[model samples]
Target chain A: MSHPGADRVRDVARLAGRSARSKRRSFLAEGPQAVREALRRHRSGTPTVEQVFATDEALARHPELAEPTDGVTLRRVTADVLAAMSDTVTPQGVVAVCRMLDVGLDDVLAGSPRLIAVLCQVRDPGNAGTVLRAADSAGADAVILTHGSVDLYNPKAVRSTVGSLFHLPVVLGVPFADLAVRLREAGVAVLAADGHGDADLDALQDASAARRLAGSAPDDEGTGPRLEAPTAWLFGNEAHGLAEEELTAADARVRVPVYGAAESLNVGTAATVCLYASARAQRR
Target chain B: MSHPGADRVRDVARLAGRSARSKRRSFLAEGPQAVREALRRHRSGTPTVEQVFATDEALARHPELAEPTDGVTLRRVTADVLAAMSDTVTPQGVVAVCRMLDVGLDDVLAGSPRLIAVLCQVRDPGNAGTVLRAADSAGADAVILTHGSVDLYNPKAVRSTVGSLFHLPVVLGVPFADLAVRLREAGVAVLAADGHGDADLDALQDASAARRLAGSAPDDEGTGPRLEAPTAWLFGNEAHGLAEEELTAADARVRVPVYGAAESLNVGTAATVCLYASARAQRR
Candidate 1:
C-alpha cells in the first residue's frame, strides 16, 4: 500500500532522533547499500529488517527485492511521503526500518573474537561509522561503542558504515571499564590507540614480524604487545583523546607513527591503519 | 561595524557557493582552524587571507589576532551577523575571506616534487578535504585537482582539510591528459589507485622493502613501479572510479588489497593509505 503523508510515515522519520529511535526500538537504513544489507541480514535469520519502504522507481531499480520474503513487509511510498520520511537533504529512494543491531557485550565477548574495535566517547557520527567500516574491512570480529559514543543507529552513522553494521557484531552502551575486564578475561589484550602512546605502531609491526621470523614467539623488548595477540583497540574522542585512566587501563598504549609534519592522524584513518596492521600480523 | 544582515554580509555569505566565489575571487575559511591557517599564510607573504570578520567573543578567544595586521582587515560583527555570514550549523564566531589558493600546474610541477596526490573527478567536499589533510600528513609536496573534481575553494572542502590546505601547495583545474604528460616528463610515476589493478599495495610494499634490503635499488619483479620513485597517486571519484583511459595512462594501476568483505576502501581513506605507503617507502 502507498502511504502518502501518513502519521505512521512521519513517526518513522522521527526515529532519526535518539529518543524516538529508543522508544520505537528501530532505526532507518537509508540508501540502497544499507537497505540491501538489512534485507540480506534479515533473510539469513538475523531479523534486523522489519519493513522496506520505497518509491516505485526505487523498487524498479532493486528488482531482486520483488521476490517475497517471510518477515519483511514491503510498502510503496509516494515521492512526497518518501521525502517526509527522509533524514537527508536528498533522500535515497529506499529506506528500511531495521531493529536495533547492537548485541549484548557479554554475548559479543563470548564468541571468542580475535579483534574488536572499542570506540569510547566518539562524538562524530561520520567518524564512528567510518571506524565501523574500517574495522569490518580489517576483519575485526566485533565493534563496541562504550557509553557517550554517538548513537550506533544514527542515520548518518548507519549510512557511513556502508552496511558493515549488518556484517559484524556491534555491542553498544557498554561501560569501558567492564568491557576491558571482559576482554582480559577472554585473553584479549586491550590496546589504547593514542597519539601520546610510547609504543610506536611501526615498532609493533616489526616486533610481530620478528616474532614470526623467530618462530612464532614474541621477544622481550618491552615494545608493547605483539599484533598477533587477540586484541581490542580502544579509540577515544576527536579533540580530547582517551582519558589518562583509559590509557592506563589498557594492556598497552600504541601510537600510529606520523612520518610527516601533520600533528596527528584523523581518528577514523588512524583506526583503519591500526586495524589493518593487526589484521595483517594476525593473518600471517 | 556590526553589519547584522547587511547586503555586504549577504554577498559574503553567497561566497560559500562556487559561482559567487569564482566571480568574487574569494572564498570563506570558516572556524578557528581554517581562519588561523589562512592568516598564518598571509603573514608569511603568501597573501591568501584578505579579510577577517568576527564577533567580540571570537576575537577574545584568539588573542594573537587582537593586534592589527599589515594586510588583513578585521571587522567586529554582532553574533547574528557572524551567523549570517556562516555556513555551518553552529558558527564558530570567526570567518576569513581568502584569495584563491590554487597555483598553476606549471608552477607546482616546477618545484622538483617527490610525491603528489592527483584527484580526478572527485566530487564530495568531505572526501576532497580529507584527501588534502591526508596528503599533507603524508608529507606530499603538492596536490593537483584535475578538471571535473569538486571546487577546491568550496567552504565545505576547505573545512574538511582542517587547515592542511594552507600547509601544502594545491594545484587545481589541470586537465588529466596534460597532467599525465607533465608528470611523466618530470620522472614522477603516475600510479592509479584501483581495486582491480594488477599491482597489489602489499606486494608493492614488499618489493620496495626487498629492494632496499638488497641495497638501494628497485627490483624488476614486474609487480609495479617502486614507491620510492617520485610518485603521484591518481584517485578517482567516489561513485565512478578512474575511466579505462585514465587507468591505462598510468605507469601501473596499484590496488590496495582488501582482507575483509568491504567491497572497497573509501576514496579519502584509500588515498591516505596509498600516500602513506609511498611516503614510508620514500623515507626508507
Candidate 2:
C-alpha cells in the first residue's frame, strides 16, 4: 500500500461512486471514527468491515482501532495513499471498506420497533445523515429511507452520521406505497411531519404528559394520536416537503410549531424535535 | 449591470470577504429567499437591504421582489453578473447587499428576553447559522455569539439561516465574561448545554410540566432550574465543546440525554432540543 496510484487504492476510491458501490455491495468509510465503528460492528459479528486502511499516525492516535478483529484485515498505508482512496480532501489517515448495512423493512418490523424515522424524498445526503444521527440519539429502533431519497451509502452522508450509521438498522429504498401499509399493519402509526399539519407536536406532548400525570391509559381521554404509542415518523424533502399523497397516507399529520417568524424548520431540525419528543413520551 | 467585470459587480463581490464586509458594514445575501427577506426587513423600516442584484428570470419568478422599497435599489443584472457577485457557484439568480444586522448585547438585554442561544467558540459557518435558525424556530428572543464563534455574516451562514437572520435580533462578538454577568443581571438564568452536565434537559422539562399540572409556581417545589424560566443556553464549539470557564460560569449545566448508542448529539441538534424545550415550557 505504498503507492498512491496503486490498483487497490483505485478500487477503494471507486466506491465513492454509486455504480461501483452498487456492484461491489460495499462502500468506503473514511476517517478514524467511521473505521473504528466499522471494526466494532465487525467484532460484534456483523461482518461489517472487510478491510481497514490506516496510516501509522492515525493508528497511534486511536490505539483502540488497532485491536484485532476476526475476518477484518488491517493494513498500514501512507497518508497519501489513504487520501487517494477517500472522497474527502482530508480522510484523517484512515479508511474502511464495509459491507452495505441496510436491513429489509420486514426485518425491521419484526423487531416491533418502538420508534422509527422514515425519510421520504430527502434529496440531500447531509440532511438524510443528520436526521439519521438524530434518530439514533433519540433511541430510535430503526430508520428507513424511502425510494427517491438520497443514498445512505454516499460518502458525505456516511461522514455526516459521525459513526451513528453503524449504530442502528437502516432500510434503504423502501417504496412509500408499501411502507405506509406495512407500518400500519405492524401497529406503528405513520405520522407525516408537515408544516401545515392539523396536529401540533407540542399539544400532543402536553396531552401525553397530562395523561401520565393523571395516570390514565393512552386511550383514556384524547381522540388524537398519542405520543407514547409505537410510531413511525415520516420526514420529507428539504425544499418542497412531503407530497400530497404521502401526507394523505399517514394516520395524522403533525407539525412542529414555529413560535417565531421563521416560516419553517429545516428538515433536520424538525426531525430532531419530532424524534426526541417521541423518545421522551415513550420512555415515560 | 450587464458587465460581469464591472466595478459595481466587483464591489458587491468583495462582500464575500470579511475585510470588505467589515469595511462596508454589509454582507452578501445570495439566492432569492435571502434577497426577499432582506427587502421585507428593509420595508419594515430596519433598512436591512441596501441594494439587490437580480436576473430577469429571478425577478420574474419572484414578482414581489420587484416591488419598490424606499431605499432598496433593485437592479436587473445578467446571470453572469449575479454569479460574479455571489459566493456560491449558483447564486440562484439573485443576491443582496444587506447591512450588518447584529445588535448590541446591552440593547438585547434591555428588552428582557426570555430564551436565548449563546454560541461559544463554534467555528463552522453552517453550524452557526443552523443554530440561529433553530433558535428562531423555537421562538427564542435573541442569539449571542461569543468572541471565538464563527462570523454570523459569513455568506454560507447567512444562506444557511434561510432569512431567519432578519427574523430575530443577534448579538455578535460578545465576550463570555461580560455576557454572563449582563444576562444574570437581566434576570435570565444562564444554562450551559453540556454533554456531561449534572442536570438533564428531559428531567427539567418533566419537572416544569409537573409543576404546571399541579397548578404551582415555577419556584414552588423544584430546586432545579425550570425550563419555563427566562434562560440563556450556552452551546460550545462543534469539536471540543465549551471552555471550562464558560461551563462554570453558567448557573446550571444541562445535558440533552442520549438514550441510544450515539456518543453525543450534533451541537445544532442539541441546541434545538434545548431551545424548544424552554420555548414549550415557557409558553405553557
DockQ of each: 0.56, 0.90
TM-score of chain A of 2: 0.98
Q: After superposition, which runs of candidate 1 have C-alpha atoms over 4 Å from their true positions?
A: A210-223, B1-7, B213-223
Candidate 1 on A8-74: residue-level lDDT in tens?
8878889899899999899998988888888888888888888888888888988766557778888
For model 1, name the residue pairs that clash: none
Model 2, B66-160: lDDT tens digits are: 89899888888898888888899988898988899889998999998999999999999999988999999999999999998888888988988
> In candidate 1, what are the lDDT values of residues B19-89, reduced to their tens digit?
99989888998988788877777888888878898888988998676467778889889888888888886
What DockQ score does model 2 reach against the true complex? 0.90
- Each candidate's fnat, in order? 0.53, 0.90
- Compute the lDDT for candidate 1: 0.84
- Candidate 1: C-alpha RMSD to true structure equals 2.2
Summarize candidate 2's per-residue lDDT along A72-129 as a digit string, tens digits. 8889899878888899999998899999999999899999999999999999988998
TM-score of chain B of each: 0.95, 0.98
- Which candidate has the highest DockQ of all? 2
